[model samples]
Target chain A: MNTVDFLNSREDLLSPGISACQGCMAELSLRVILKVLGEKTVLVVPPGCMAGAAVGGWNKSLGTKIPAAMPQLGNSASMLAGIKAAYDLVDPDVHCLAYAGDGGTADIGLQALSAAAERRDNIIYVCNDNEAYMNTGFQKSGTTPHGARTSTTPVGSVGRGKVNFKKDVPMMMAMQNTAYVATLTPAYMNDFVEKVQKAATIKDGLVYLHVLNPCPTGWGTKPENSIAYARAAVQSRYFLLYEYRNYEFTVSAPTKNIREPKDVTEFLQKQKRFAHLDEQDYEEVRRVVNSRWENLKKLAGL
Target chain B: MENEYRVVYGDSGLYVLDTASWRTFRPVIDETKCVNCGTCLLYCPVCAVKKVDGRIQIDLSYCKGCGICRTECPKQAIMWVKEEE
Candidate 1:
């Protein structure tokens, strides 16, 4: 849809004055998501920054105009599974959505999410990957990049930030042949909106969307730079923007045409989390990001 | 029973936070340059930017002043004015 058409789409579903940090991408994401999902949507935001920010509501009330709930950290997927099943009998038109963090999806709730995908549950699951558990003081998550520092992955003599590379959740889901799996960022609004609208249409199986939620507080980025950093992340190919479904994988726009991606350092240097990374560290990060991009390309070729 | 209900269920709008104080900068929309393209309205985390009547207006009461609207505006119609003491 064009800008003017997008303007008239839907009213913002979130109540004003949520406590998300300045330029909170996750908050922007949730607002747009709920707008796309509309009133017939039932939202389940697990224990993350979004939940702590009151998407699930506070004080015996609801934060969203629609009914919402905060499930246990690990039970987010399973709980949504149950709710979607119930909604099938009661109101099948109702959209059942789970907005979770990487800590919840990759570390804690992987099994349940996997099971739901395998069983072909018609639910939308979104992992807002801020790269760490930001609400709980930015502990390193399974999706945290190798050289980025978090509270747990300090840049001290003993620790060189996160030791391992980020776990590729969307690729994993795509490999399983889920109904739909896509990575998105708000920086690319058209692509982001189109994918979300597509996710809402699939009634055959579970849809997994991993959104780049840049945490201004946790990542030590200027709040205004969140979208710019998001755009850079894709430009540098540090995070590939692509979608998978029906055994077909296609890289989306922004990063799709680039031959030589902008240096990974262009993306990394802006964040305080990568402040301590030296030339050697940048080399390793470059290796990891490039390999992952090439791997996705190879998979697409197959 | 009424006292217990009041304490537990809470007063009206008890959870609504006034996020205006979080601002370090305020987005002032330049009327001459703005065509009401709605980019600012699209990217706001709080959805604080709105189109009231024919013009785009920002609700400062809820605007956290992240300056996202300013940076993303195509015409550079929104200015980030510093909030001073």
Candidate 2:
């Protein structure tokens, strides 16, 4: 569909007053996702930004108007699997979506998620990676990049932010050989919508979407710059947008042929989370980012 | 006396909850300047802008007033106005 047609066709499932911070891309992603999944979808959200964004404060109902179940931390995948199993008895066409943050998917929920993938559960699992434990107050998580500062990884004397690299959850899911695995960002709205649509069509096994949702509050950036940062991430090759299906890997259209790539340093400098990085730290981050780009190019047979 | 709760299943009809009270700033479109290009409609996170009868309408009920539509409008047709308390 064309841009206008697609925009007009959206049946916005999310209500306002969600308490999501201004320009919170997790909320944006959830809205777009519901538009694609439509009314026959059941959402299973754990305790994270996605849940907080949907049902916060005095709002007891999940504003999406869809049947939603809130599971404990790290239990979303299994809960969604159970929900999908029960739905199979009545209506097998209902989409079961498990949405979680990086902390829920990469750290606390990995075991259950892996088990679900192993069982070939018919569900679509979405990991909205904001790169930290943002909802609970900007603590470092497994996906937090090295040299980025967070509450847990404060840049103080004898402390140099987070020392570990971001976890590659998409690669791990692809290793499981699930029906579909892809990375997306809300900045690329068309691409993001298409991927979610494609994932919904897969009936045999699990479909995983690892979306990079830039958090203005946690990332220490202006809310207006949220989409700019997302675009910068792709242009700098810090986050490669690609899909893995049928044992084949292909980079998405936007990041596939990036001529005159922007420097990763420019992208890092925009966020206050990386303000503490010195010259040597910048070099280290650049080296790591370049190597990741090279590795992805090799995989894509460039 | 017995305490009882109704267990409703998938029957919560779409609730059109008005969220204008939560808005600190609301988007006001300049109709004369607008070309109905639909650029603002595409970038609006909440999908608050709707096209009805070939004109764009912003539904304040679902609009969190994020100002993304104001920021993304190519024609600069959307203006952010402070909501009166």
Candidate 3:
């Protein structure tokens, strides 16, 4: 069956309805992850966009048909690791999922996540990265790209948005000796599904899937452009789709074929957060993205 | 089942639970043009796109009308009709 047919054949593990912003790729990606993981999975959504949107449940009714919990913001990965340890005592087949935002993953949760990865905790930790603390009004997070106008990184005569490049969380996780590390985007559902499926099979240690999602509400883009922006992010090499396992790296097919990356502006220009970027800033962003893309190609032995 | 989503989007212009009012341009699915690819259903964040009786339909009652389905439709099987007061 094709992608569409295959998707339709699977059961939606999430509830029938969720209140995430329209065209929210993070929410859509979460649904796909759960679909691939199936019913024998326990979901942990830290205090982030996914939880705030009620993916952790609102009342007596569970948000997901399966068991779910909303853990503290910074402890989702370690918490999921603990759940996995308990599951090992029981079924061991049950997957423990940590669905957290970039803020939770790269900021407050980094310590616990690093510790979990170091201990080789068996859990799948997915970082839904919209570049900042989006649900909390777009404050700057560790993963926020340089020159993006997050709420905390206000643009003005004095302030010119975030002054640092986006922290390469996937590479960091890979370096930490994770059993698996992959980059995901909602635009390529096939790639996303494949990575999530591969992650489900990893049992030896932590699996880190870092998704660069588009938040229209936070990025000040039209909601419909969420997927478009996600596509551009990869096409422009601002985000590369790749997976790391067994100490080897391979670029996903979609990203591997891009011989000439589209101009970085194609991705940055779509978001209001990057509106203040001058020509020089664009060049700088292009330089950083290209350098990172080249580094990945080397790692993949391209 | 709609009661499962009580989070209001007053920012979309009202304090209503029925979020159909939040749509600026309602998606009009052209069943005649549709090839049943299910692209709309897969990309829809709200799961508003559904297959009922083997026919694709948009659940406008819950659709926030982001127009992503229409934009993503390879066949252009969906149209965007501006919501009228």
**Each prediction's TM-score against the native?**
0.94, 0.92, 0.92
lDDT of 3 at A284: 95
Could you tell me how far off, in angstroms, the CA of residue A76 lies in candidate 3 after the best superposition?
0.8
The local lDDT score (0 to 100) that residue A288 gets in candidate 3 is 91
**Predicted candidate 2 versus true structure: per-residue lDDT over A151-236, tens digit per residue:** 99888888889999989999899888877899999877788888998998999899999999999889998776778788889998
At residue A294, candidate 3 shows an lDDT of: 83
- Report the number of the highest-TM-score candidate: 1
Question: Residue pairs in steric clash, candidate 3?
Answer: none
* Tens digits of lDDT, candidate 1, A119-197: 9999999999999999999999999988889988888869889989899999888988999999999888888988999
* Model 3 interface RMSD over true interface Cα atoms: 7.8
Each candidate: what lDDT? Answer: 0.87, 0.83, 0.85
All models, DockQ values? 0.45, 0.39, 0.23
What CA RMSD would candidate 2 show?
2.3
What is model 1's DockQ versus the real complex? 0.45
Instruction: Rank the models by DockQ, top first.
Output: 1, 2, 3
Tell me the TM-score of model 1: 0.94
